[model samples]
Structures are given as structure tokens and as C-alpha cells.
Target: MRVFAPLLALGLMASAAHAQCGGPFPAFVKGLKSEAVAAGHKQATVDAFFSGVQQDPKVLKADRAQGVFQKPFIEFSRRLISKQRLDKGRAMAKKYDATFKRIERDYGVSRGVLLAFWAFETDFGGFQGDFNTLNALTTLAHDCRRPELFRPQIFAALTLYEHGDFDPARTTGAWAGEIGMVQMLPRDILINGVDGDGDGHVRLKTSAPDALMSGAKMLSHLGWRAGEPWLQEVTVPADLDWSLTGPGQNLTVADWAKRGVRPREGKLAQGGLPASIILPQGRKGPAFIAYPNFNVYFEWNQSFTYVLTAAYFANRLEGSAIYDAGTPEPGLDGPQMKRLQQKLAARGYDVGKIDGILGAGTRAAVQAEQKRLGLPADAWPTMALLNRL
Candidate 1:
């Protein structure tokens, strides 16, 4: 890993870029001021919030690099469940069980999942990013790629500043402008911020209780079910079509069992809880039937590993009986993955680029190829499939 850049340099470079870009930013700021004024923010509120903002080239680069928005699920998961990570998660769970329990009681989100998100987002609050929060949000807003998303964050940050929820000058966070242990964006800070510590102020930056509680609050709002695990790894009866794993269908646990789907961890009772199956890395990798709560993780980050990692980390934290049972599939690395992408595209797969990333688009193309070859249509791109490529 490369050494991190100095946060102050990042702060300065960002502010200068936007002020000098001269791309109707004045109009954007004017429109923003009008919006704030219309929303009942005082003139001082708009001026104080947007005062030092500037376009940031670095943030633009980061935004551009997020193109196609997908990564292999397993590959993303390994880093999350590493031994060090698991050990840390366990410690956090045990040390903060009471906190987790409180959140669970109030929000229906288990301590495990909440703690898991806590561990993953900021290493259990070990290091929140160090950019001036307003500057970072403004930088991200100036980024053209996804301005719609980041612009609201800019507004949200300003609102938070106006309301005194955070002092924009003192607050620092990720380049993407997420704050606290769970990396909450400014909008989430607006809507989902909760005073878990009951300090009369929902301070996500310094208060662990506030951050964790707010994190769980976000999950709860997204449909967390009390006492239900997100979903379980299951054994599908031989000959079941594995390709039917994704977000579209919801099957009852019992309904799945009847169709030859059984929890890999022995027989689960016939509770007809709605579920969806996700087959990441295709049929060759592990599969899971996701429950309603699983979708909550998706709300935070729309990646398979992100959702499953939160769940698996939660299980680890909770001392749940099972964690990840999925075996590591040998998938190609950057160069080899690009080679495979090129070959697939040449063979009419229509993968967008020869980038080594096996995003959903690449996975879909891989699935199409497997279907044509009469292989499992699960769309898992592994070395096994790559050999054929």
C-alpha cells in the first residue's frame, strides 16, 4: 500500500481547484445559497458553509475511477474477514455487547451486524479520515461524474453546519465526506443521525455511542428484522437451477426448502421469511439466500462483498455458530482478468473494456458464456472458467 498523502495538502489543493475552475461554480454556489435561503437557512448560514469551497481534481479522479461500480464479491470479502479483522471484530462485540444490545432493543438491528459495520467502516473508529468535512463534501460536489449524489451531500453538510450539528471548520472526514465510525454521509447525518449516547447532541465525530447508534439506526430504517439472521448459506438439492440467485425474487425459507434448498447448516425450521439468493462469483463460488435485513447492507454500499462482509462480520462479532463457509475460488488478478475480459469481448461477450475487474457486466457476460457452453449459469468467473477462455 502506498503511504497516505498529507491531509492538509489535500485540503488546500481541493479548495484552489474549484475556485479557479470557473465552470459556473459561482452559479452553483448562488443556486445553493438560494436553496438554503428558501429552506430557512439564514444568509450567514449559507455564507459560513460555502465560504472556503473549491473544486478538487483528486476527488474528480476518485469519482472517475469508480466507473462501472462493481467488484468480485469474494475478492472484496477476503480482506474484510481476515484473521486480524475477525479478531478485532470479536473484541469489539464482546467489549461493547451492552451497546450493541441497546441498539438491538431499540432498532431491531442485532449487535453483531452493527458492530460489524463499525469495524469495517473505520476500523472500529481507529481512524476516521482527516479532510475538512465541508471541503471534502464541496470537492466531491464539484466532481462532475456523480454530482447529483454529491451535491446533496454538499447541501446536507451545509445544513448540518447551519444547525450546529457539526462545526464545518473542525470536522474532518473521508475525501468522499463520510464521517464517524460508520462513515456516514452528510445526508445520512441529517436523516439517520441519532443520539445514542444521549449527550443532547448527536455528535458522530467524537462520540462512539452516537456513531454506532446512528449506524444501527440507518440499518433499522432500511428494514432490519429483529431476531432474524440476514440469511444463511444453503444446500440446494442437486439439479436445482443455481442461476436464480440475485435480488429479484423473494422465496420463503420453507418455499426454498421445498424446492430443494436447505440451509447448509443442517435443517432450518419452516419459517416462511422472505429471502433472495445471491450467487457471487457464479455457481462455482458460495451462494446465500438473503433476507430483508441483507438489503439494508446493500443500502449502505451496493456491492455483494460489502453486504455479506457486514453480515459475516456481524456473525463473527455475535459469536454466531457459523461465519463464512465459502471456499476461496481462484480468480484471475488484474492483468489476467483484463486478458479474460478481452477474450470474452472478442468472442461477442460485449464486456465494456479489457479492465481486469470482473464487475457485474463482466460477470453477466461470463454467465452468458457459461449458459452457451451448457455450464452452470451462475456466472461465477473463476480460473476454472478462465481455462476455457
Candidate 2:
């Protein structure tokens, strides 16, 4: 379930109601440079870097795709863990066993979680997003929606250039300016980026270890307990309180036990872990009693469902208990999802495609769908809606 993280003011992208382009680009670019100067960037650094840069509409479009699809919890978990990816991750795990173990030993994050992050972010380092990081971030900064967030990224991307990670021509990544296997933003890289390979300079431009280790460092900073499990897949009480699901609301593991929420596999831990159970599909779906570590994963992307997927994938990579939540409620099944897609398309929605695969695209469509149905379409697809469809 996507518990909206209070609608951040940063990173808002283009919407269907408006299209922004051209003529006003230079003014926007100058605005970012001015803000960068205010934020302690050298004026020349900002000027030379952004003077000739232009807004990338494609990057803006990609940002729009951020939460376009919504999938079943199991399918979303499966989406990032095909057999080949898992095999490659295992191979990396063993090949880099010494390195990863050393990282885990030093940092307290598990090797499996490390590799799962590796797999999740870049598909074992196969397809990091391709875009000029400097140009992309500058464009995003100039776009008016997230100038504050992306402006610093633009400055930092320039810093990466001055530091010799890559010339401007070579540096590129996800439209959001996140590079490498872990998809970190330029600002994140500036603060948390590491030099894992001992290559004199810490660089994510070409080093997987740098990226992976840096990601671990970020997660660790976000409060991942060295040996603590991010979450426990569990059978939440049938009558579990809905009000206490998100952060701030809490329960002791012992209190949860008193309420009969047990670990889906082994014995649930005692009340030491602060936790809450989330019903992603409302009722009749898998439940996870998440801890602080889960919040660490959420720090990467503020989606409850994404956190569950990351933790679940971490479990699969680790040989831990797999969530067996019986059957999903009849929410958005294949055919139903397709119809929703078509409905979205007919209504002039761009949900990537009505391919019947619920993903970021479908989620956007569902949010649009919910708005149409006058439902609280935070874009979470549950099984009950499937039967109704």
C-alpha cells in the first residue's frame, strides 16, 4: 500500500493539464544558477555549466513515469527478481563474497540485502539510466517544479565533473540524475557517495563497488540495524487496527504478539522491535510488520509497497522466510487491469501502456481511475476491486 509521504514539495513533474517548453528556458536556467550561488556554488561554476544547457523534455517525461504503475505485492517483488537476475546476483554475491562480507562486517547491512539493492537499482549493473547527469539535473532544476531539489544536484554534478569522475560529455544517468547500480541522485552522491574500490577517488561513474557501498552507507545512515531484519513477513490479526499502520503509530512486538500477529515463518521476536503491520491490499493480502530498517529502504523511495518489495527481495536473496499470504483479494487481476488501462487511455491518460501489467504506469492510471471513481485512489490496487471490476 502506498502511504503517501505527505506530498513532498520537491520533484513534482509535469501533469496532463500542462506542457512546459522553450523560450523561457534561459530565464529558468539563470534562476537555478542564481540559487546555486546562493547555495554556496561558485557563480562561474554555475554559469559555464548551465549557460548552453537546455531543458530535456524527455527527462521531464521520465520523471512523470515515477509512480505510473501499480502491481500486486507478489508481482512487484517478482518484477525485480527474475531467475537470471537472481543467478547473476548470486554469482556476484559469491564472486564479491569477500568484499560484500567485509562491507557487511563493517557496516552491519547483510550481503544479501546489499546484493538485493544492487539487483533492484540497476539489474546487477546492467542498465543504469542513461542521460548526461549534469545536463539532466540542470534541466530538472530549471523546470520550476523541483528547482530547489535539483539545483543542488546540478551543482554537485558539476563538482563531480571538476573532480574528474567524468567529463560533461560522458556523465549521464536516470533523468532524475541518479547514476550507477543504486540510482543515487547527484546531491546524495555528493554527501554519501563512496570510493569502494580504493581507487584514490570515490566514484560511482564506473565502480559498482563504489555505488553499492555508497548505497549501503546511505541506508546505514538511515538507521539500518547491523543485524536487524528490515521487516517480518507476518499474519496480521484479522481485525488489526487500520489506524496504527503507518509511521508514528507503533506497537511493541510483544503487544503485537498479544494481538496474535506472528511471524509468518519462525517465532516472532519479542517486543524490542518497534513495528506496525501494513495491509497493502486493504484486507486478504500479505502483511508485513515493518521496523526501522524498513524505513531505511523507504528512504530510497518513499513507497510502502516498494519498501515491502525491497525487503521481500532481500529475503529471497538471503534464503530467509518467503511471504506466503495465501491468496490476494480479487483486486486488479490481469483482465481487470487491462480494462482499467483502456479506461485510462480512453480518458486521455498516458499510463505507459494498457499492457495489463500493473506497474508505475498502471498506478498512475489507477490514481486517475480512482479520481474518476471518486475513490481514494492513492493508486494502490487491491483484490476487492478486481471482483467489482
Candidate 3:
């Protein structure tokens, strides 16, 4: 789930009779209420759900100011993965061993993967955010920036309300409206929620079994392989063809071994699983060969650095060694990154926004440019590469 600063202000406004997405906050909420009724919700139910829900300026501010993802992989990973978290994750794994076993058997999702998300999302349920989920969803839906994504979640939450699984005023979660321990959106819970504890209710906030089983089901639906490895650190040949790296350039493990790519520990994956070498910080830093299972991680979170950290954390939980942090060069700062994005956009590379964040689209464009300029196409943009462009 996307982290945000704690709620700073809870602002409320009078509701309007008209419908809109942006403009007067009341009108946008009115529009949402109408939409909910049009989608078959009872008017009373819609009213109750929208009652006391107000536009939270803090949620909007938090949504627009998500700069935490800008950190490089090493720094980001080191910051998130700590010894206490590791110990807690292992203890939770042991505590919920039976549930985890059932989830893995039925859903193909590993315990470490689920535990990693659990630890990261809410510190194993120590704190599941304090934002009122309905208000957060409505406030985000009222904003035009990403209304299409958050608007539907509002109605899904209404469904939960009707099913007696949600409380419009009492339910609390992340600023982005994800609820419970693993911080799933309402729509995801509607589609993949499981009553794992046999308590007849999918209480993700209170029931660890419910949260883990539901998360595993969601991951399985997202194409998680039953018993396949997701990521493995590997040593690449100094003269390896870096242009052949990145996500789309997958090759068999046998082929990679032929090119002198060997695992840092253990043997390769049967020499048949298709994998790609990813240089998160260029060839000078740590390298990992990502298997097809790793692609499922993108379905969970879009931030490449976050996904890599999470996947690597899962690998570590499964007894993998700590990745070797090599002496890699520093990345571009905000202004430099924006300038590079502008240059790439000028060259017809759709880098999404000129926001100075090295997102997936920008990374892909950088790799293409690097290949075109006869530089190492490891997809990690550097100053020299930027200067050449």
C-alpha cells in the first residue's frame, strides 16, 4: 500500500443536490451518491454511506506528494527491511503456520510473500492507519487527478456496508482507501476476500487468517506461480551484454548460464524458467534474475523499487543471503531527472509525466536511449547517460 503522512486535517462541507466530480466538494459527493444509487444501491444506504463523509484535504495532499518512491533500491530496501521486522515476520509465520500451509496449498502463494506484505503494510497489524476509509475514498473520488481509480472503490465499500462487513464511520485504513492488515482496496476485497478463520466473516483488520488467506487468493488470481522462484541474486560476467537485460528480454536460465550468469547461491532454476537480469542500480550494483513469478509482484505494487525490495525481502525470508551492495554510481536528482524525462519525451518516449520520478515508463525509455547510444542498457539512468542525451 502507498504510505502517506498521517491525517493532518478533517474538513467537512455541506452537501449539494447536483452531481459532479470536481468543483464544490458537496456536488462531487452528491454525484457519487447518485452514481451509487444508479448502480442499484438503495437511496437510504447511499445516504448513510455518504453521511459524515467529507472531503479530506490531507488525503488529496498526500496523494499528490508521494515522493517516497523516489529513493533508490538500496536505500529504500535497507530502510524498510530491519532485523525487528524480520524477527516479527518469522514469528508471525510460525504463529500462523497452519493457515499459511493451507493458503499455499490452495492458492500457490508462499508464506514469506504474504508475511512480507503483512509486515510492510501495517507492521503485522500494529497500526493500520487512522484515516476514515469512506471519507478517504470519497475525497479521492472527488479529486480529478485519479477519480476513475478511486471512484469505483467507493461503491465497493458500499457493498461491504450492505453486507454488514463495513462501518462507514468506524472503518479506518490507509489514505488511499485500502483497508485492513494487508491494506487491500474495497474492490479487491469484494472479488477475492476469504473467510479464512471460519468465523463467517472476512475480518481482515482483526483476523490474521482472514487477511493472509485473502491476500494469498488475490495474489494467486494475479498469476502467482504455485512453486516457482520469483527472484534470485546472480553474478553477471563483467563483459556481459547489458543491452539484453531488463524485463522484456527474458532468456532461459541455461542460456543465461551459457553467458556466464551464475546464481550467487544455490543452483539455477532447472535451466528452463524464463528469466531476465535486472540491474536496479545499473551493472555496478546488485543484480537479480527475475523469473515469471516476479511479474506477479507488479500486480501488487507498481513502484519498481518497492516491488524489488518486497520480492527480495521475501527471498530473504526464505533463507536467501543478503544481496551484495556493490559500489554503484549515484542516480540523478529531481531536476536532472525531470530534464532527462523531458528529453526522452521529446524523442517520442512516453515517459508518462515529467515528474522527476524514475518510474517504469521512464526507466524503459532510458534503456531504449542507452541502447541507441551504444551504452550499457541496464535501464538505470545515470549522469553520463543523461549528458550523452
Best by lDDT: 3
> Candidate 2 lDDT, tens digit per residue, 208-321?
788778878877766778877777778766665544554435788888788878786777655788886655554466777777677677667755457677777777777765
Residue ranges of candidate 2 with Cα displaced over 4 Å: 1-23, 31-48, 237-248, 332-389
Q: Lowest lDDT 10-mer window, candidate 3?
A: 5-14
Over 81-181, each residue of candidate 3 has an lDDT whose tens digit, in order, gives 99999888888888999999999899888888998899888999999999999989988878877665676677778888998999999999999999999
For model 1, name the residue pairs that clash: 18-55, 281-380, 282-380, 338-356
Task: Provide TM-scores for the models.
Answer: 0.81, 0.76, 0.93
**Which candidate would rank higher by lDDT, 1 or 3?**
3
Residues 195-308 of candidate 1: C-alpha lDDT, one tens digit per residue = 877778888878888888888877676667777778567655547675565665677777777787767665564467788767765544666778777776666775545666
lDDT of each: 0.68, 0.66, 0.86
What does the lDDT come to for candidate 3?
Answer: 0.86
Error of 3 at 248 (Å): 2.4
lDDT value for candidate 1?
Answer: 0.68
Error of 2 at 167 (Å): 2.6
